[model samples]
Target: MTLSDTNHAATLALRALAWTLGEPARAERFLALTGLSPDVLRASAGDPSTLAAAIGFLESHEPDLVACADAIGATPQDLAEARRRLDA
Candidate 1:
């Protein structure tokens, strides 16, 4: 992805993470699916790797990905691409 695209993805992923955490149940589900705890999430939420993992987690489940993308005003593909860039 281009640098601009990657930057957009990162921003979208952070928004997606916020959307996920907006609801208690959704945050719990994310934590469970990602094998992350509240403590870890708090500690790493700002880190690129953790942000990428959150996007990757959403991407792994299409329904969640679509929902999250919609909620964050981003395309699912952008979130996925952001994960790839962050992972790299």
Candidate 2:
């Protein structure tokens, strides 16, 4: 479940965020749940906090987590570990 095949965890988190936000509905849902505005997302996409939030967004729901993991060619655990590392 390592992210050895991908970029660093922070980068992977951003990739997951982009995947979650690719659909307007999904993006809107993420914003609603996380209280993050598009401006803020754009501004802090590189921050550890933002990356952690994005991974948390994916981790909150099984369907989204699995889908995001698959989309990014990673396992769900990898994303979770990535989040933990970023937060630490």
Candidate 3:
């Protein structure tokens, strides 16, 4: 992804994580790591990086975060399957 896209992703991921896990501590740490403010996170709806960083952070703390590879409760294998489908 482009630099802007990466930043945008980072923004969205955080929002999803904040909403999904209801973990403000994780979200705040992600914001700090990515140099994003609360306003920016609110503005970007679904940037991959935002989601990615949040997941990444959570994964470090709790590997089960891998279970959410898909947007709607997809497992890690499901994510691989989705990728396979996309690449086909």
Candidate 4:
């Protein structure tokens, strides 16, 4: 991907991550599901794998994916595309 595309993907991933952590229950669930400790999450916030994992978590549940997309001013497709780019 181009640098701009990569940047956009990164931004979307970060936003998705924020949305995931915005609620205590969701955050706890995310941590449990991903097996990522808070320290690891914080330390690797900018890592592509971490970012992709965040989006992946959202993608795993359609309701959450759609809800998060709405909350973050993005479409679910946008988030999926972002995840693809991050994976690439």
Candidate achieving the largest TM-score: 4
Residue 50 CA displacement from its true place in model 2, Å: 0.6
lDDT of 3 by residue, 1-88 (tens): 3555444444444434654446566556767776778888666535544555455554554444464444444455443333333223
lDDT (Cα, tens digit) per residue for candidate 2, span 43-76: 9889888899989988888899999999999999
Q: Can you write out model 4's per-residue Cα lDDT over 1-88, one digit (the tens) per residue? A: 8999999999999999999999999999999999999999999999999999999999999999999999999999999999999999
Tens digit of per-residue lDDT, candidate 1, span 25-60: 878888998899999899998788899988877877
Q: Which residue pairs in candidate 4 collide?
A: none
Ten-residue stretch with the least lDDT total in model 4? 53-62
> TM-scores, in order shown?
0.84, 0.90, 0.45, 0.98
Supply every candidate's count of residue pairs whose N, Cα or C atoms clash at under 3 angstroms: 0, 0, 11, 0
* Native-structure RMSD, model 3: 7.3
Give the C-alpha lDDT of model 4. Answer: 0.96
Model 3: runs farther than 4 Å from truth?
1-16, 19-21, 63-72, 76-88
Candidate 1: C-alpha RMSD to true structure equals 1.8
TM-score, candidate 1, is 0.84
lDDT of each: 0.84, 0.88, 0.51, 0.96
The local distance difference test score of model 1 is: 0.84
RMSD of each: 1.8, 3.2, 7.3, 0.5
Candidates 2 and 3, the one with greater lDDT: 2
